[model samples]
Target: MNRARHHRRARAFPLAMLLAACAVAPPVSARVQPADAPADATKASVASEIRAGVSGKLKDFYGPRGYWPLWVEKDAIGPQADALLALIASVDVDGLAPRDYDPRGLQRLIEEADASPTPKALARADLALSKAFAALVADMRRPARGIGMRYLDPEVEPRDPDPSGLLRAAAVTPSLTDYIQTAGWMSPFYMRLRTARADYRARWGDLPGITVPEGVKLRPGGNTPEIALLRHRLGLAQGAAYDRALAARVRAFQSDHGLAADGIAGGQTISALNRGPAYYDQQLALNMERARLLPGPWVRHVVVDAASARLWYYSKGALDGTMKVVAGARESQTPMMAGMIRYATLNPYWNIPPDLVQSRVAPKILKGASLKGMHYEALADWSANPAPLAQSEVDWGSVAAGRSEVRVRQLPGGDNAMGRVKFMFPNDLGIYLHDTPSRDLFAKPARHFSNGCVRLEDAQRLGRWFFGKQPVADGSAPEQHQPLPQPVPVYLTYLTAVPTAQGVQFLPDVYGRDGD
Candidate 1:
């Protein structure tokens, strides 16, 4: 019930020794070398091969330091290597393939080092360790190509690694996993979602499919073929008949699917019931892939899940509040991107997009609609000529036909489309969070009503959260652009399956983004 409270507990930091260890690890050059082997002889040969096999920016990572061994030291596997091996092996718990990070090769090298105890054996492990470490880092921060460009593409900066710095920390960190967990390993939310995956995999891993009769519907007390199938599908007691218990299950099922919690199995509910475990597994996997794309963690941030039509505010690495939001419709789906909220505009002007001007307003003006209490100017005049133009002076036909351009802006007031406030973040797509006149839309189960911008039900509250001051209701003359004391990162994500206090809630994939 208290989602924010639960989030705080989930994101609590690990032990203090862990933090100190990460801070105290010595630089790569200062690390101790094997006693018998000269540092320049075989180390140079192994480092050269590592440069060839590692390739790319990573190959040059050790060029300045003469390609020193990262994982092995003193003719054996060191603390850093042992810690990295364990972390790579546990990647599966985060929905990542451990093999992709070369756990098998790392294990074999460790075995060889234990048997031979030679500088050559140690060198081989060092090379594999460096390559696997680089691969893990890359996979953690960068998303797959298909998922990144699925919607309005995000401007994601490639994670430029500091190989020496990371190696230094790995050497001293008490737990390498904990030290790197918040870096680029995975999003904190992904850790929470993994619990849901584990729960489903344990209970319904081998569930069979349920077939709902095409034309039949099952209500609380109905006796249809579909009802019998549902009872069996849910795995109720073999001889037990459908009754109040069955109704409770149906209501619970509806709640999980983001539908009205009425004790009825309608077409939508039946359709969901018909899906087997494979469908859920695929959904979980796809969402996990999506989570892998996030670059890194932010101490304070805002995360908007367009699939669920909700925004969660995270302050100081914990969920502080949640608000309902209206996202872009299916046709013009909201994009998945991350940006920082730099400033808030009070009583903001709604500069209508060109597409809206041509599609919605030009036709209305042609039909003799009065442009009362709004500002209008030709786009050409604003840029080149600088002259005022009356609504009647412009040719609506020319504007609609793309022969001419006009700029339509709505003055801030009660009826303005952008409500009273808007949050601005610089991005190429020009999409941002703003208040809406259609406040009632937030009450709907699915709030996909915007064109491309996000409509917040609690925009004023968000303003207070960002600036520590709320906007005034009166339509002031000078628009206020207040800078936030601390800019907060905002991530717009598309996740269909997320864990909650009760269980995992499966949201409708409004954009049909789930590739499966």
Candidate 2:
């Protein structure tokens, strides 16, 4: 595929509209209730509650909207809102918002946003809500087991959800169960079902051996067609029956696709395999919600779809340069929100976080030797790591009493892990995009591999885009701190569906998040 083709397609407003979601819904004021001020106050209260319940489950069930008119009498969904709510809430969630009103507004807004242009003028807001209700209802009821994050029953993989499919399916299928599974060949949905819940080992079999086809053995010593296919994806060597190469490829694919790439095919990979094709459409829907929350003219900025594990840049409607990224690791998952670049560090100091160094990194160090290619720092005193934790020096028995502190930096060059440079973006969280020595990870369809911080595709290119005009000598700072000559913006938003050159691209929702 011509990278430019996709680059151009992604730049296309309609295409980008598919797999991206920016949470741009305007916050409603307490006073400005909809025109239909509580026709049946009690019923309105119940309906609002149901809407909230449903939106709480399916992260981006509704697309994007300024407001929803679910309260309008026209929707058939009014009667069965509870049913839809149950189905959506069936999906797993890593965390949930405690607030009640948030989900209600969010679900309605998503439905309203994805509604047809015809939907906007309809006399029935209930019809729109009902449509959303129906679609999600069908998603959970599918006869086939889901094969992505969690496996479902056997069945037909829905055809790729195109623009029109989104409309028709929107009225029928709801949870995107069919979208992630059957949508094949240049299908973006392959990326959407990637998720690693806590229990892959116990529930499902080994992860690497998973295959839709029959006769594939997952044992490390066996080389089967399934293994070869997986190996090919990972850029590993193919050895007739038992290709050692397939292990890495399977691991990478599993990692990228949000499977537990233990070189085994467990329940998670199966669920990822069988997800609905419209997952990308869902991504588009989700991103549209996110976009409504963004400041427009998103020029000269990086977009990291945490859901898809893909990064994008829009400079005059084009990617700054092509460099795929490895996002947050499953445990240190990336968040769903927006942030922008402020400054970057070239050969910058690595300030390891306290909690991570203590709990995760230090233990690995205590293993006494590096595992595989991982690196760590050693210090006689525990004070070296510069994070503001309450204590220091881990006491094996009272690990809690130990302070979360460890100073470690992977040096620049080949083994630097972070590669030659990093791009710094500002958010309440200490997250940013940077180049990684692990370029190999990018080839996988799903890429969740980092400690919360986003690993960008191209460091130099991102630097130029963010601070290209700024000047530098000793690298204190770029002189060109002024805004871009044309003032560009980068939007790092979450999305499941995004339009592509061929059609819409559905991606995996790596973070098993529920709610829109």
Candidate 3:
């Protein structure tokens, strides 16, 4: 029951921040009907507002075919419009603000219609509602700040989900909401987390904070006064005893939060248990934002969950295997990006990055003391086409002093940094997945030791899968490159929570990238 106590204000969204409000509508002069407003007036206002302020891609989509009202039938709000409003209101379930999608002027129109209003107001409402509906669908389909906010899918350009097409289909379809929901590519993990959040907010959200001593450690079959507080905090009924049931609950909580499920309440597990409802809610919110950037299902792919330092392989959209990984350290964080693995290289050489050379290797090797099993190369220049210089011809002091540019490369050998192979997915960031000789580091609970690239423990297996043949394990003299039978997409993502058999397992944010 020991939990950190902090009050968090509920996030506020101003109605003025609604994007639909920025649109300009056509002037309506005559009285309009709710069920059968003037078709021409509705069309004019809807097209003008959408084209003027919705989004460039959407605007271009409708512009080619005269701005027709997508969600209006008989000059009134159609079934599609009704379903859209319902979905917008419940967007909060997905950690999005419903106010962001509220249709401008729709409320006023509803009031006026009740009070026997004129036709022009009704026409204005219909048009505004249609435009707002279009904007909402667009937002729901992409990242919050648009696709540009995403670092993972940088190459995934923002292609507008043609709202006009969706509206047309939804108009004739009875299951409009269900059809629209299909467009979102939310994973099972996200859906489960959403369910967990809703359940937490409903039951124990208002419970009084309970404190557990920081140094207290409780094992199974051990009795302490804090057991009562723990039962109450965990929603157990009063008069509960510190028995096997209490131990089971503790183990479940630890497993869900990525702690060792030993049924022992230690300081780390206590801290995780101590997190209040708001903390969980905020984590879910931030993760939802990260999920928005992810691409949809792929038949076969690789995913690196940077937060957990794990690599997952999927076949036919199902997770087939996984392995431990070493991600970037805190100062040099692994970035979120997506690319296609086109090839693999066996006996790959490690061309040391200049920054690492200047900061680490140069400082140690400058004293002219050769390190064990270390190979240093002096280059004519730091450029890609640098000429090689023999070890005896180069002055180590001058290279260390920055007076001369030297290229430091470790040749392919038993002790090479890139153990036996490296997977290449060409990207501007100079990051890739490769093997590391320091395989023992992967056994650590937190594996954030790499400079920036991802180090894989199962590089040989991955190589075999990609190349359709086993890689040379002996670190042969010449490096060999083989293209994959077919390119497989790789997503380097940062997801902290994933649904497991036990529950939603929340991994530690090794990179400290989770803003919450």
Best by TM-score: 1
**What TM-scores do the predictions have?**
0.66, 0.39, 0.63
The TM-score obtained by model 2 is 0.39
Q: Tell me the lDDT of model 2 at 235.
A: 39
After superposition on all CA atoms, what RMSD does each candidate show versus the true structure?
A: 9.8, 18.3, 11.8
lDDT tens string, model 2, 1-516? Answer: 001101001111232322222222312421235553332222233233334443432323333322233323332223233333433443332122213223354355434422521222221334344444434323322222221221111111233233323333433333222322321111122122212221222222233332344334464677566655545333345554544455554564455443456866545543444342233224343444343333211134455667677766654323345566787876887765444444556555345666655566657646654422464443434343434322234343233236434344443445665565555544556676666767778788778878887777666666666665532325433121323333333445566545443233445556665343
Model 3 poorest ten-residue lDDT run: 1-10
Q: What is the lDDT of every predicted structure here?
A: 0.67, 0.42, 0.63
Clashes of 3: 3
Query: Which candidate number would show the highest lDDT if scored against the true structure?
Result: 1
Cα displacement (Å) at residue 467, model 1: 4.1
Candidate 1 all-Cα RMSD:
9.8
Evaluate model 1: give its lDDT: 0.67
Please write out the lDDT profile of model 1 over residues 1-516, one tens digit for every residue: 001110001112234423432333333554545553333333444444444455455455555555555654444555556656666766675656887877777878877765664545665777677777766765555565667533322334444556554454354444554555434345666766665677776665655576766555677666656667788776665433558888887787676555677877788877777777678777887787776655334346777888888887865444678899999999878898878788878887777877878887888778777566344334444442346567777788987888877877776777778888888887777789999889789889888988878999899888888877775644485357877888877778899998776667788778988865
Least accurate stretch of 10 residues (summed lDDT) in model 2? 1-10
Error of 2 at 359 (Å): 4.5
Residues 288-390 of candidate 3 have per-residue lDDT tens digits of: 6666555443336787877789887766334667899999988888887777887887787788877776666666776554533377566767576678776
